[model samples]
Target: MTRVLLIGALLAAVFWVFSIVDCALQPPIRHRGVSKPVWIIIVVVFPVVGGILWFAVGRARASALAARRAPDDDPEFLDRLGSTSDQDERIRRLEEELALLDAEDDDPRWRRPVPPPAASQSTAPGDPADKPADRPGDGDDDARDQRGAAGA
Candidate 1:
């Protein structure tokens, strides 16, 4: 009976230590409008009862609060799921069907010949006008031009 009592005491001490450390690491529970520090004091001052109370009530409340604050779903996770190859295949098939339906509709702009670049432009002849402008002084021209304009 004495040995059993000693073992029980040792087990209780271990449980108390575990509970205290776990509670300290976690954000404190707010129970019935009482703050976490009060709960921590109660647990530390009255180990067995405090530890049991924390496990039963405090931890649950804190967990619930954290869950409520957490974001609903991960954007990257949803993106990966939504953009899977199966979805891409479905989109491709729909686009092909649309193309077939629109084949009879002639839009001249889609088949029009591209205009040639101006002679003064040193860019490749086939390049579009919207392509980046080629300039001899691309690196320092803007600053020099600004200073020149200011001086004038």
Candidate 2:
């Protein structure tokens, strides 16, 4: 008998703790009869009875859960979105800016062609552009002259 009573008391204590934690942790919007703090106080003050009351009265109803909807489905949420024409105008402006940028990248005026060196311009002997063929009496030319003479 004493063991039964002890077990009952232990169960009641666990229930009271669970109720208090549940009430405290619940969002203010989920509380029904009173505010969250009040629910927690009720559970703390009344123990088993307070826990039962918190579960029965303070908690929000299951049907109320249906009020929540995805932002895309909610009328208030959809109302906040502006007209499609306004979005289209923004998109059109963005596309025009992108086209303008691409045009700038491709424009010949933006990138001038590097002109080839004039035929009249003199090059130094050590210049990288001064090839052996460009110089008179080069070894290759002498060799070609020898070969031509031998062939003749």
Candidate 3:
């Protein structure tokens, strides 16, 4: 009886140490009602009863709650979701097309011809009529020439 009690006491001490260490190391498993420190204190103080209570009620419940809340950790589920390679391939194709268009547009031979200056347009900046009209799409062919003259 004495030996049995001593062994049980030793086992309880070992279990208590393990429970405390586990509680310290693991991120506190959150649940709806009870907080983590309360559970830790219960486990640490009560030893065998606390450890049993924690494993049976608190720990199991917390783990089940976490599993239900977040299922993305499952590798099989992720595998079934399909790869992003197709998206990458589509983006690459678009980038290649853009590059081709840029190369074609940048080539001097494919460039649009610059329009010749209008006959009535004066290149002088000081001319009252040469002041740029605010109206949109007004034929102001000499604007660039006047700016160039002013800069020089």
Best candidate (score: lDDT): 2
The whole-model C-alpha lDDT of candidate 2 against the native structure comes to 0.82
- lDDT of predicted model 3: 0.69
Clashing pairs in 3: none
Q: What is the lDDT of residue 114 in candidate 1?
A: 77
Query: Which lDDT tens digits does candidate 1 get at residues 1-94?
Result: 9999999999999999988887777754345335677767878998999899877867756435543332337555565575568899999999
Q: Where's the lowest-lDDT run of ten residues in candidate 1?
A: 132-141
Residue-level lDDT of model 3, residues 13-74, one tens digit each, is 99988877765655665422356787788888899888877666666444365354244877
lDDT of 2 at 118: 73
Model 1: lDDT of residue 126 = 62
Which candidate achieves the best TM-score against the true structure?
2
Selected candidate, larger TM-score, 1 vs 3: 3
lDDT of 2 at 34: 79
Instruction: Compute the lDDT of residue 111 as modeled in candidate 3.
Output: 82
Among residues 3 or more apart in sequence or in different chains, the pairs in candidate 2 whose N, CA or C atoms overlap within 3 Å are none
> For residues 1-152, what per-residue lDDT tens digits would candidate 2 score against the true structure?
99999999999999999998888888788899878888888899999999999989899876776688899999998889988998999999999999999877877788879998878758788885566543335434344555323323
